[model samples]
Target chain A: MKGISHFLAGVAAATFVPGVVESAAQGSYLIVLGGFFGLLPDTLDFKFARYFEHHINIDPDPANLDPQIIANAVAVEIDRAAETQRAVRVQLHNIPLGPNRWRQYRIRFDAERNEVVITIGPIVNAALAPLDESGQRVARAKTKAKIDYTYDGEMTADIWNGPSFAFVPKAHGVEVQFLPWHRAWSHSFTLAALLGLITGVLFGSLQAGLVAFLGMSAHVVEDQLGYLGSNLFWPITKGRSAGARLLHSGDAIPNFLAVWTALALILFNLDRFSAPVQNRDPLLTPWVYLGTTLIMPALILIGVYAWERRKDHVRREVAQQADIVAELKETEV
Target chain B: MLSVIPSIYLAAPDETSAFIVLPGQKWLLERRGYEAAILTGIGSLCGVIVLVLLSPFLTEVARTLRIILSPHFGWILATVTLFMLMSEWPKGGDRGPTNWARFRAAWSQLAAGLLTFFLSGLLGLILMYRSFAPVPVAFVNLLPAFIGLFAIPMVLTNLIMGTRVPLQHVGGSIDVSPALLLRGTFAGSLGGLFAAFFPVVTGGIGSFLAGHATAQRDERTFIISQGTSKLVYYAGGLLLFFLPGLQLARGGLASMVSTIYTPGTPQLYYTAVAALAVSGAVSFLLLIPYARFSVRFLARLDYRTVNLGTLIVIVALLLLTTGLSGLLIAIPATAIGLIPSFYGTRRMNCLGVLLLPITLNMAGVGPDIARLLGLA
Candidate 1:
């Protein structure tokens, strides 16, 4: 089940990586595609969780979804040796995304099995979806009867693991990690490496590795691009996310590239061509692409430099105050 | 010269002696009252325009001519311009070229332009008011200020003219000199040439003052060293009294408010302004040829005494124009005309502190008088 879940996760990651890159190169129209495609797997993870909760006998209230609480409860229940009449539901209850940190999990808590399996979607995707049975298919009066409904039993479904879970912060809402895990691929790297091996059996190692790497990296980058940040130090700390509110919806690199493509289209139409065409994409003007791409980084760097200077000044003043307090204490002694 | 014109015309003008006679005779004196009025009105209108425009131009021409013809002329021009610029608000200093020499040289050009327009405006008003038949008694009452304005521009232009380098090299060998300087022993004297009626353009006021000075003593001397007598000084200072007319024309709300009370309505105010501007321009045109001719004429004669006699004769002629002419009309007209000039003078100076007090007083105290009289 773990291997199958991990493979499904790899496949999902594979779909997103190329989509984001292609969209970025296509200019603004595809930027919308990139944003939607980037959040798809994350949203699916929560949907599976909701499905699990409904199938399980556990009357898990959808409103009670603090990761820490779940972690503590699972720790206590797992450690106990009683005939725990535990009912487990792994769910992703759909809830409206508000102005706060959010997480959607494909969570499974088992008492008899003594196992807790949980996977989280990107923080940006934790939002409510309508609870409807129309989405799930059921066969009636068939030769092979299928147990389609499990509304009063413990959930036994294997959750699909995607590359997005690679950077899901360790239990969420803890600041032990220095930088966002989203910046670097976590579980995505291993998944891509394994997928590359499988692809090498079918295709060639180089092509498979390139395709898998590209797919896995795109998923990681897209999740990181969102404001919630990603867990880049995944297996080690699982408590990493990075990014500020500014430019939160996408990675700076892709956003910069998308803007460059749009600008190139505009400049190309005007016929004031300065750079040689890379490909015969008549829409592609090289100067605008090169200029905007180069200029934006410099501008962002300058802004960062100024912010750091001001921050350093504030730190110095704070240190001075601390020194004064220390001296006062010394005198008191 | 009187006999050179047909004697029969002067003898035949017996019918309209009352209307035709003007105070100073230049040509025909006898004419109908209506003809006199139309001519005087047109002439006054023309005079005003010329005074406003040409005055500044003439001052520039003088500075340019000096720059071209003389050594250290720039310093002299600067000194004169600054002195004229600073003269209005006299700070306590020994009054002489030596004491104020440095300052005089500093801002001379700007001062010259300001003072020239100022002096010409005064003269235009005096000339306008005097042109009226049976000059008004109220103007006569304000004679000192009127004559002072009319007189100041003349004195300064002549002083400027008299001091010009009348001799300049033309084509390397020959000196082209002013004609007035060559005419006779008395014709080229700087003092006398400056005093001439035709030569000095700022009404004959300065000549009149200089003459007054000379009359008190045997010979003319430096104004600072010998000192203009108290009477002459007061007469010159009385020029300030004309500020009311100019103030009403331009200064504060009173000027705008006075539009209602001004005799002929707003049209008349415009007409008066237009006339002064026209006259200034015309005067400017007439003076250029005259200045050129005089420079060449003066170049021919010996420097000792030729120009002085001619200038003396000219000053004598101007005296006849102002003295016999009704000061009753000319004086007040000039005084009223000069108020705007004080504003001009104030703005031209580096420090305009003197105008500040005067402006406050005029804005403040002038209204109080109007209120006391219920004129407000």
Candidate 2:
């Protein structure tokens, strides 16, 4: 679900508060609070948690290892992969602080042997000079550093424990991982419950706290619908559970339906609360309400779903044809 | 009101250019040098003249429309707007770079147009319609809405996506042939005239129609014509507000002005026209330096930081003006806004937000729909 869908779901929940409670002091505000709470789960993961998580760093001693050698070795491997028609790529970054010291030099290798280099300042440390036996400094020169390339075909390269590299296959390519804390405690159901409890205690209203819990839980559950599942139970669940792969975050129809449904419900609630006079002679009869609010939106959603499935079927057919053609070409080669 | 000024940056590419002037058009403009600029200027002047000439007739038509449509027209229009949005929904998935993909991409523009229209209406009704709420908040929430939907998203995408648009140098003496200038001006002005006359028709649509009508083969000519069309849509639209006979309120700025003061005199109309002319000239002069400065600034600064700052500013402004409710509205608006870019559809679908509601009102179904939903 998109961000707005989550927020709307929260708003829709608030609209469902009993009419009597809504008339009570700060009732409307509390209901609105539910909507805000609905956004809390994703908000925690995207706005706060993502930043706290760190990427794994692969730092090599600049004094002994020239980054150029690594760059060349990676380039060689990329070329080899390309020659064999295997997809691979490499990304290089070099940031210089001074003549001899560099802020950072990072290289990223992808499944397809494509190389992308980002450089800040200069590549080599010009200030570093080797001393001769007579205490005279030798001139700065370019030197190649040797890197071991021999490894099993497996993508994972855990050469050392301190700077372990894990290559995980992704939709686009293999993601070279340096850090492990993704979809952890922050995306946990336990945390959401705790937060809800804390909020309830502070606000002196169990209902308010429940709204908070519902909001957070809604987000966690929605995320579980995607391929990347959340750590539902946090400490008890050590790893993310495999998700029910029905849709992606980017899928348009599901997101649209969620938002539309939420909006429709919210509007219905708003009409009920705001127009007491109209309620006596309501413009929308029960039948009309059933047709417009529920039936129409549902029909549109169903239509979109069917259309998408047909499109997907067509896409799969094309992909299979392309695969067959590629196999034939490889055999010819 | 102050926040409206920043909206120009958002409006420039989307509302002003209307996505008619493609990359190819831009490249042609750059390649053509001074000729393109001169032609653009002439074309804009022509557009202004056409708009000025057409104001009285269009205003009368608009007045008649309001009277005839009155009460139920808003609903009917709103419904039509929604249908337009639905019709434009992108159908195909990621099919690589096939012709079908391109066709889907082109058709998806309607989706954006619909979404934007819908969002604007939703926000307006919630914030401005006093009849529906116990405590009606009369504050104009459009600025914040636009900020969240268009401005913030644009800046954030630039930052997070790390996609840098290379800015080409636009400098040198301009030299346009008189024939080219005349042709471009006529075509552009005609487009502007049509846009001014029609409700819900933007400059982009007008220019696009004109481009086809005139069979404009040259990209440079198309770019120059679009430039003129934008000026007419904005400046000429403002000028129309002051026309004594017309009393027209065409664009946002003009609509705002009309709320404060009614136009009834030729003297005031002339004054407004003069102001527009002076402002237009000053803006033209400022544009070159601003463009150059922006290019350098973008190149030197980290786009991520720039975008982050922009996002913070928008949030602060939203909080200051519309407060919590406005922020809440922004959350949904942003998500809807992202749909176009995310799905690789046209951003125009977002316009359906306003169009759907407004059209529904005109059709007399809006109130019933509202009643059914308990919002009436």
Top-scoring candidate (TM-score): 2
| Per-model TM values vs. the true structure | 0.20, 0.43
- lDDT by residue (A68-184, candidate 1, tens digit) is 444344333322212232322222222223422233344433323333444433332111212232222211111111111111222211111111111111121111111112233
Candidate 1 Cα deviation (angstroms), residue B42: 66
The A-chain TM-scores of all the candidates are: 0.32, 0.55
Model 2 agreement with the true structure over B1-376: per-residue lDDT tens digits: 1111122222222211212324232332233223334445545655655555555455454554343222222322332232233223222221224435434543454445555566656654553342321234433545555566666666655565653333344566555555455445555665665465446656655564344223233444555566666677777667767767777677778778888889888788777766766665666665555544554554576645656787898889877767776687777778767765554444545555445555555444667766665666
Candidate 1 on B1-376: residue-level lDDT in tens? 1111112111112111211111111112221111222222222222233233433333333333222222222222222223233223211111123424423532343354355444443333333333433344333333334334434333333343342222332221212122211111111121221222111111122222222212111111212111112111221122111222322122222234455554434344445445445544564455334434443564575532433544454446434554544444444434433432332222222112122222223233434543553544
Q: Of the true interface contacts, what fraction does each candidate have?
A: 0.00, 0.00
Q: Which stretches of candidate 2 lie over 4 Å from their true place?
A: A1-333, B1-45, B49-137, B173-222, B293-298
Recovered native contacts in candidate 2, as a fraction?
0.00
Model 2 docking grade: incorrect
Single out the weakest 10-residue window by summed lDDT for candidate 1 chain A: A159-168
